[model samples]
Target: MRGVTELLRPVWRTLPWPSLGAGSAAGLLLAGMARLYPENFDPWLALNTLRTAALAFALGLAFLLDDPARHTTATVPVPRFVRQSLRLALVAPIAALWWTATVLLIPAELRPPVGATTLEAGAACALALAGSAAWIRRSQEPEPGVSVAAGLLTVAVLAALLLPDDWELLVAVGDPGWDAAHGRWGVLLGAAVGGWLISTREPART
Candidate 1:
């Protein structure tokens, strides 16, 4: 308990607030577009707007692990896993609230299936965190956020443009392929979380 409390202040200080704030603002703005013409609400536009908002926030999450003091803190008594977990712990609730707000910004009648859309958002966030963790594991860079964000953007674009029809992940709510698409989202969420856990482990000491 004491140990955790001691680590809290430093961990809080290290968070990437700028990126997170920008991402959240961008997402909210996009989601708010759904309310622009309350009488003309379109379900399809609401769904895509939410999707874009999720991606925007996920791009910000790509910076979650960034710490300019990484090298300095490497020798701390607390394990890297604990520190990283703490960071996630601190941010998770805020992210959840942000998502909820984003969803509620649209008219209920125009909103997509909450469960499916939430799954997609969760998967996107997991992928971003996984990429950040992987980059940290493989490099000595103290701040890898920019590179990770760029990589995430590139992957998103490629996935949208190049993925074949049978493996579609961004299908419409009522499409016959919707169920299968979310199944794929489940698989992706699992894989991304597994990768993040593996990458978060402390590197073996020589």
Candidate 2:
């Protein structure tokens, strides 16, 4: 009701619409690629997208939750942790809807294995929650050089994603398609670390 609406107001105001739009576009492009290049319709692609979105959502939520400016008014009293947890909870159903819609749009043959889909979604949610919690805990007393490190890490992650795919490297190591799988997880972990560093460095003041 009113309480729920009020709690979400700040999150809505600070929502990263640009990033979200970019992600949605990227997802559509990937899906279209699968359709156009049926021969290259690998399940790994879907897994990568799922994991990346999961991680990104988690990082975004952490940033939004930890922003002190969101709680400028003292009139409303609400625990930060409670608000963050509720936001995380809301992402699940939305994710499910996204998954359903994505499936309906893609060719039947391009659909990912159900188990893999479930695993990736679960990993995304778990990593995001863990990242947000870590960020909140660290925000209590942050160190001086952490922000720089976080910025560097973020750049590194982008670089990794932009690198050309190496099938030979993937197979030589018996990784098969794990590069996409593990890479997404690595990005999530890096994002979590960055969020933790940022959250720890800034003191919460209302």
Candidate 3:
């Protein structure tokens, strides 16, 4: 347990930039694309991008927390689950900070509906954190062939969820317009999963 904690410390320090970069890039691209197609784009779509970026950031933090590098000294005294919980606890505030910054960076007109956006951002953060915890606790690194299979399965599931029927289903739940507002949920989800996988698994010792 001490070892795991020690291993994760360095990851926590260094992994923030890459995750922030990915989230920012994803957010900016979505915003840019919306601007390009003003006639077709709904301004509210920016909110989705912001929410997605927040989730990506949260997931990235989770990966950093789980990195084997941060666990070195961790074995001395701490129980593994306790350490893991401590790391997970950090995700909420960091995600909140990221969301605050993101909201500040957006143009007033392009920002999400005020109070609702905050709630959505918080929800995304929670989802990302929960998902990462689940993955870390239950999943293992797959063999090459299995990895490919898993990737394919993820794609299939995403497609099924984002396709026309899926859109209709979401609409049935509430707001059919939301399905058409932003189509980047799949990309955000993929980023969260990929970032978690890449960050948490052991890398060659540096």
On TM-score, the candidate that comes out on top is: 1
lDDT, each prediction: 0.91, 0.49, 0.48
Per-residue lDDT of model 1, residues 1-206, tens digit only: 67878988888888999999999999999888778876665787789889999999999999999999899988878877788889999999999999999999988899999999999999999999988888999999878889988998998899989999999998998999999999999999999999999999999879
Instruction: Name the regions of candidate 1 deviating beyond 4 angstroms.
Output: 39-41
Residue runs of model 2 more than 4 Å from their true location after superposition:
1-5, 42-68, 71-75, 140-206
TM-score of each: 0.97, 0.54, 0.50
Residue 81 C-alpha lDDT in model 1: 77
The alpha-carbon deviation from the true structure for residue 137 of candidate 1, after best TM-score superposition, in angstroms, is: 0.9
Residue 150, model 1, lDDT: 93
- For model 1, what is the error of residue 4's alpha carbon versus the real structure, in angstroms, after optimal superposition? 2.2
Ten residues in sequence with the least summed lDDT for candidate 1? 33-42
Q: lDDT per residue, candidate 2, 122-194, as tens digits?
A: 4444444455456456554222123432443374376556656642111112256655655564565567655
Off by over 4 Å in 3: 1-17, 28-41, 70-74, 88-93, 139-206
Model 2: colliding residue pairs = 138-200, 139-199, 139-200, 142-200
